[model samples]
Target: MSRRLITEVAGVIEAPVERVWPEIVRTVPRTELGEHVLAYQGGWWYRGEWSVTPVPGGTRLVHRVYDVAGQGWAVALANRLFIGFRERTRRSFAEGLVHLGNRLGCATRLT
Candidate 1:
């Protein structure tokens, strides 16, 4: 039995997906690269995906965290008990986008 818990955050970077892709791969070396997605799996349950999409002015980057455990309910419960899990995830993504922007020499804004 598999239950899944997911959270997603997205931002727009003022650059093309082509430009952002290499940097993402460089920054996250252990990812499984797909068309526009980078996937990372860790431990027994954690799965993370970063996807890029072309927008009018630049690229949209979305990060999603998934609990892919058979006991995902327990994982969700533990996360709830941990407090501020969602907030921390969002904050971390925001910081990451800022860092990516610095590296790319471009602007980034949460979407």
Candidate 2:
């Protein structure tokens, strides 16, 4: 059996959640984040369930790493070799949001 790692990052976007959602969405895509994100090959991140939604706190990005047959090894490797993946992914997404927000019109700066 393999366990998936799930986490959330909340940030205020000068624009509404809907406005910010699309920019945020792109970073998770392989093309946008392929350089910075780890554990990815080709144009996919990992075999998982994902969603973005609006909530009282802010826009919520949810990602789940799953194990189904062949993916069992990936889950195990992620656990053993990349235990810090959750934090890394969180930071990557956060930084990406800042950049996207800037490009999309918001001038928020992570630096």
Model 2 steric clash pairs = none
Model 1 Cα lDDT, one tens digit per residue, 1-111:
253656889999999999998888888646677788888888777778898999999999998887667653575676675477667889999999999999999999998
- Model 1 pairs whose backbones collide: none
Best by TM-score: 1
- lDDT assessment of candidate 1: 0.84
Tens digits of per-residue lDDT for model 2, 8-107: 4445545556766566455544333342222223223344444455655444444445433345346665468557866886687677657766776764
Q: Pick the candidate with the highest lDDT.
A: 1
TM-score for predicted model 2 compared with the true structure: 0.49
Off by over 4 Å in 2: 1-3, 24-45, 48-50, 55-78, 107-111
List TM-score per model, in order: 0.85, 0.49
